[model samples]
Target chain A: AQTVTQSQPEMSVQEAETVTLSCTYDTSESNYYLFWYKQPPSRQMILVIRQEAYKQQNATENRFSVNFQKAAKSFSLKISDSQLGDTAMYFCAFMNIGGSQGNLIFGKGTKLSVKP
Target chain B: EPEVTQTPSHQVTQMGQEVILRCVPISNHLYFYWYRQILGQKVEFLVSFYNNEISEKSEIFDDQFSVERPDGSNFTLKIRSTKLEDSAMYFCASIPPGLAGEQFFGPGTRLTVL
Candidate 1:
């Protein structure tokens, strides 16, 4: 069974600063996909960034990026130039490359606070 | 940009009552899925539907739960009898191409079983 773990339950960063949220997963399949999602107090899950297992290049989206260490099974999200609007619950998710069921397995989530 | 839309942003019902959550995935999408998140808990997968049938489901998706694409546009999840523990935010997502593709999520419906 594949499981995603977000060790950090909460995180805080000053506006204009940077913060990183840690994530790890257990998967036997070599080919898969990793994702970072942000859910605000409204409880809407929004896709932030995605990383393909086969790509050594980490994924970057404007201000959000990922440091994907496949060997260690670590996929961490880094938010640079953090803003107040960035405060939300962040989740790490996993999905198989090819399967009939394309559902994503998500972590417990990390509550992020962007302090001004 | 096209997005998935779910109806009844919030629903409160007595325990043992039946509740149906509806979602309209992107028109071009093929695979649809349902996930739930209990307050302060991880988002858990419930079931996946494709080709108008269930492709897969989790242990949490027991006999009490069923999904249907009754029409060409809408997807629905019906709980035979809602329980207190079933109260959570239900999310509806759809995969644009197929597996290996990114999934787009809906705003989610908060189900409160009282």
Candidate 2:
């Protein structure tokens, strides 16, 4: 069984500032994938960024990046140059790349508010 | 961009009534999945479908729940008898064969069981 934990229940950042959302997971599988998803007021789940366990280098997608520490089982999402549109409930997810099922295990989520 | 789409953006049903939620996954997607998120709770996986059959299911997907791909572009999840506990936002997702871990999700159907 795998579990994802988002210790921060809420986070706030001023417009144009940077924010980091913390996430940790417990998984026995060595080969896996970590993802960050954003859910806006519309409740549409959108992929922010993804990092593979085998890839030592972190994943970056424009303003969204991930700080993945495989040894510590930590995968945090960083939003640089944050904008009002970045306000949303962010979730950290885990998936097994080699399993029969590719279902995602998600964290409770961290609600981010980008204040102007 | 290609994306998954779900029908009946919102559904309201009485207890013991049957309800069906429909989705149209990405045209080229090979893997389909259903997930639900209760109010103020984490998203939970319900089932995964591939090859016109269910390949994996969670314990929460009891006999009361069923999934089908009735047509070439439609995927549906039906609840035999709705319960108050079943009220939540149901989401449909799909993954292309080439993208092993990327699952694109739909906007989600909000189910309200009273």
Candidate 3:
């Protein structure tokens, strides 16, 4: 069994500033993947970024990045130059590398609000 | 770009009634999944279907729940007897072959059981 935890229930950031959302997981499997998803008011879950356990190098999108600490079982998402559009519910998810089914286990999610 | 789509954006049904949620996965996807999220809770995986059969399912997916791909393009999740606890947003997701862990999600269907 795998579990993902997002300790922060809510977060706020000023426009153009940076914010980091925390995430932790419990898993016995060594090869796996971590992901950050954003659900805006429209209720669409959008993929933000992804990180592989074997790859020490972090994954970075245009304005989204992750700090993946394999030993610590922590994968946090950092949003740079935050915009109002970034305000959404952010979730951390985990999945095994290879298997017949690749269902994602998601965290409780952190609600983020970006203010001007 | 191709994306997963779910029909009946919102559904309200009485307890003990049956409801079927439909999904159109990405055209080239080989694996399909169903997940649900209660209000203010984490998303929980319900079941995964592949090769026209169920590959895996979670404890939350009981006999009351079933999935099928009756046609080549449409995937469906059926709840035989809806309970009040079944009120949640049901999401459909899909993954292209060889995409490892990248699963694209649909906009979710909000199910309200009264």
Assess every candidate by TM-score.
0.98, 0.98, 0.98
Q: Give the poorly placed runs of model 1, Cα more than 4 Å off.
A: none
Candidate 3 chain B: 10-residue stretch with minimal lDDT: B94-103
List the candidate 2 regions with Cα displacement exceeding 4 Å. Answer: none
In model 3, the runs with Cα more than 4 Å from the true position are none
lDDT of each: 0.93, 0.95, 0.94
True contacts kept of each: 0.82, 0.85, 0.87
The order of the candidates by DockQ, greatest first, is: 2, 1, 3
For residues A1-115, write the lDDT of model 2, one tens digit per residue. Answer: 9999999999999999999999999988998999999999899999999998999999999999999999999999999999999999999999987775788999999999999
Candidate 2 lDDT over residue span B1-114, tens digit each = 888999999999999999999999999998999999998888999999999999999999999999999999999999988999999999999999945888999999999999
Q: What tens-digit string does per-residue lDDT give for candidate 3 at B1-114?
A: 888999999999999999999999999899999999998888999999999999999999999999999999999999998999999999999998975778999999999999
lDDT of 3 at A63: 93
Between candidates 1 and 2, the lDDT winner: 2
DockQ of candidate 2 is 0.82
